[model samples]
Target: MSGDYSIYTGQKRTFTIPDYVLFSLTLAISAGIGLFFAIKDRNNVTSKEYHLGGKNMNILPVAMSLLVTFLSALTLLGTPVEMYNYSTMFWWLCLAFVSAMVLASVVFTPFFYNLQVTSVFQYLELRFSKPVRLLASFIYILQTCTYMSFVLYAPSLALNAVTGFHLWGSVAAVGIVVTLYTALGGMKAVLWANTFQALVIMAGLMAVLIQGSIVTGGFQNAWDIAGNRSRIYFHDFSFDPTTRHSFWSVVIGGSFFWTSLYGINQAQVQKALSCPSVSKAQIAFFVSLPGLILIVSLCCMIGIVMYAFYADCHPMDFNNLITTSDQLLPFFVMDILGHVPGLPGVFVSSLFSGSLSTISSSLNALGAIIPRDIMKPYCCPNISDRSITILSKVIVFMFGGVAIGLAVLASQLGSVMQSSYSVYSVLNGPLFGLFILGMFFPWANAWGALGGALTSLAFMSWIGFGAFANKVSTAKLSPVFTHGCNWSVTTTAMTVTTTLRTTTSFTGSTEVTTIAAPSYPFIPMYKLSYLFYMPTAMAVLVIVGLFVSLITGCRDPKTMDPRLICPLFDRLFPCMPEMILRPLRCGVNHKGNIRNKVYEEADELPEKIQPIDANGVEVKPPHDTEAGVLKGGAINQGFEPIDAKTPGSEECITHL
Candidate 1:
């Protein structure tokens, strides 16, 4: 212990050998998984296999990977604090997960899967232009990299505060282990490691919940105490956009936010595309939803248990036990599970597992994006497959180093760390809007996308940063009591004096002076809840995009390829007349190909009948046409034969 414990609990606790061993095993197994895959697939060195598991990955592992990729250390450490401080209204975010999954599975997956592209940004290029693709790719790279750095740093900081673990050492250990496995084993390693880590994450959360419940006299008692304290709120159906965690804000705004993440973000799109078939990819997303809800519920309940344990004595108010809310969970773990030997280690391992799964997924995603989006298309078009494979692994290590360095720098950025969430929130809406514009509106050209994205970025940044600067907080914390604290004599005297001085000024009249409430500049837009940022930005982007497109001579929907457009009307209103749905789909063909557009112009047909096998190896087709097209649905099914010469090509048919 750091000798600071005597001020409060008069007990010093630290990690034991069992704890360290458990934590070490988590890291070792993750790296070991990478090594096993690296050695097993040594002979086959291809970019597709390395980045996408040759698009033949099993649904279960990929589903687990998707679940864990976005569920980072931030969610593990911060969400419990959110629940303890505010209300369980955040639980409504589960509905957002369901909505996002529905949109991703029904709207986004079919479009991307039909294209058979490496990166999701490729859709931007096919739908609009290369510049649009590059812009979106660059934004994604910046956002993910910065977010990953914070993800690596936050847990280490919390762990350092609770345990005596060196913060920088934790950062290095996680960064190195994730980089090693991701670079060596590639996507296969990432998926399996994520699956294992997901289990560890749940186990750790369960340990905390079970132990905390026992300490608080069981779950029902804890719930009753929390409910009595008004922390179990769920039906906040306020119509005001500024009301944070209200049913509308969380469900509606959260829907757009999560849809942005799952629908268009490269990390998620890459994982979804790893499956061999469109239905498999959709199934993976649906399967992940239950896990998402389970994790969120566990985190929420842990907060309630935390509140029940410290119902009378708030940790921060009692001798400043913790300097930040993020440190609360770890401190509570040490307080309750300190003597439990390996439990602390298991919890810490769970924290590290969250970071490892996230960073590994991001590293693998960056590895795929950099090579496919930037390097191959622009930097070196003639780059061979073997060379691209080598380059991708190298890029993973390089970006891993960059992330680690940024994480070290993040230690000095105290308040900026808090503001980073706002920054991420603002960007999600605009990015999702750009993709929506491309997919839904056939008239939206490249200029419109660029203009809309840039405008939304500016508009959201103004709101996000302005709100941060104004110290505008929408989530009002419930009252906490410190009357039950066993304060030291000296500290008690100092606190009494400080409290009296704030409420009364020393004047000759001996009259109590009323202190004026701090004035917050009332900016209406700035007061909008963070949850609304995504939907608001999306609206701005779509309106601006449509305006710009109309002014700049919009594309004729009839001439555009139907594969690039989402068949929204056909899917939703199947009973509607074809003539009505055709216009609603912006002239997209019902059979999934436009009659007026040649297939060759939209997507290049392969010159040989080569398709990837279950093992991710290339295999020759049994029958090949004179035009070198495979007769059957050899390319993972749902695709029709292409007629290069004719405009009525039955290519890229959707089974979705």
Candidate 2:
């Protein structure tokens, strides 16, 4: 019995020919999508088509693209580990997703869509100054690069654990494949590929959940077993900020984190801007919510099933079964499903798909931002469209290489979900704050925005790096048992013997070591939960920004562009009295000033407001004002200009 158990434990599954074929087919499909698009759009090598899909994408594909862009292999692999090791409190992030998407649609989406800018950071230049835009662009580049490294590293780590693939080789292969597709097909290819990958991810997750539950005797049995083992946790209402996944942290803190991604992150915002109109973009955002929730729930439930499956024979308790929690899911897949041909391939492909979608999106965004925000604006304004296209492809390839290199360094980090979130919060928090300051507070000057962002960046970096260096462990892992194992393994007797030997060697005494140990002093801020990082950083930026704005002499709201502001107060509370709304607007004249001016000007003109063409040449207005000609002669039938005094007028028309 002992020999058989040892043999069983030692033997690991390898990918069979069928598994390899299926995995290859996945890669081939992704590449083929890019190739098709590359050939189809070969003649139209303009920046607009390459970067924004010609601003003609449909709602469903764009919605799916947005969903997968942020999901990543980190979510697929790390989220399950999180649920298995900790509590289910993190599942409440579904609520955060809801609130974050709504806020993005109402606030950030309109601003980006109306501005007609190639890069989201260009809004900073228009709102503040060139220096502020440059600063933001650099921060976004750093943030996305860091995040891409984690995404690329996650699947590679899991693959190595299960399939015995060389870690760096897997990283290099995935990174190169994503780069080639992204460079070849651009935004169109990325979005379409994302749509396909999203289906694979869902199918893979469902397969795992269904199969695991069946193996565990059913989901109800799994649930009961998990509850018995104290794994079914959801009602942690603790207010302590240090509690890693309390109700407050997962919902409130997670809201800010998701908002930073969905609302303001370039990779996400770029997808929203691909739509022809703001309404379609908003629809896409809402459409993505259900799928997002499904994916997260699937990952969480998979964690529960895994815990139940290993309730007795804990994999980690066995000697060297796995080195990290992140490896647990892939190991479970191979141990359970490897015998079934193509099932392992499906799971592995899903992991790769998640990483490919995320990395490709980041690379595409980098390609767009380098030329649109930095190169064309400052370095070479007169560069031709063809040269810009070439430059963008080169930028994508270079950044992909950088991400592959950084992935090797990511191996040194702790839990993928926690470490990635910590790094993201440090940068994204400040970036989101800068956008909020500009959109909501019209009085905020460039100096204030710049000061606030820099201060927040420095402060968060200190806390983040300090916590990482001190190795402050916040996770409270659930207990595991090895008593059920039939094989000879490290047991209580071995542990006691090892402890006695260490004690004798250290203290020159044979007394047993006590359970109570000396506690080392730690910084309170350093021990702050990773969930609160974004909120803390945002608060710092806003407080410092307001203070600095007051000292630097606030920019007059009257002089500010109404198109840049979100009109959040008016949109949310339409019936609020002007007296209260004025201050809450942070000095933004959302409705009365901008709308009144446009109407006043229109009434004074004899032949209606003559619309300007795309080339800035004045053009004759269409025969009637019913279609509402925009400032640049783009006719949007959606917004018909109403009387300035009319109640609940479309104030957003001023943006057009």
TM-score of each: 0.85, 0.85
Q: For candidate 2, write residues 1-656 as lDDT tens digits.
A: 11112213344477778888888887889989998899999999988789889888999999999898889999999888887877678999999999999988887887666556678877776666667778999999999999999999999887787778788999998898889999999999999999999998998898889888877778877777766656677888989987788899999999999988998888888898788777899999999999999999999999988877776666676665677888889888876677788887899889999999999999999998899778876889789878988899999999999999999778899789889999999989899899888888776767678889999999999999888988877544456655555554454312211100101012122222223322336577887789999999989998898788777566556534456678887766779998888788665445522332232212111212233333333445444542123322223223343444433212212221
Q: What is the C-alpha lDDT of each candidate?
A: 0.75, 0.78
Instruction: At residue 204, give the lDDT of candidate 1.
Output: 96
Considering summed lDDT, which 10 consecutive residues are worst modelled in model 2?
496-505
Off-target runs (Cα >4 Å) in candidate 2 are 1-10, 475-477, 489-522, 575-583, 592-656
Model 1 score (lDDT): 0.75
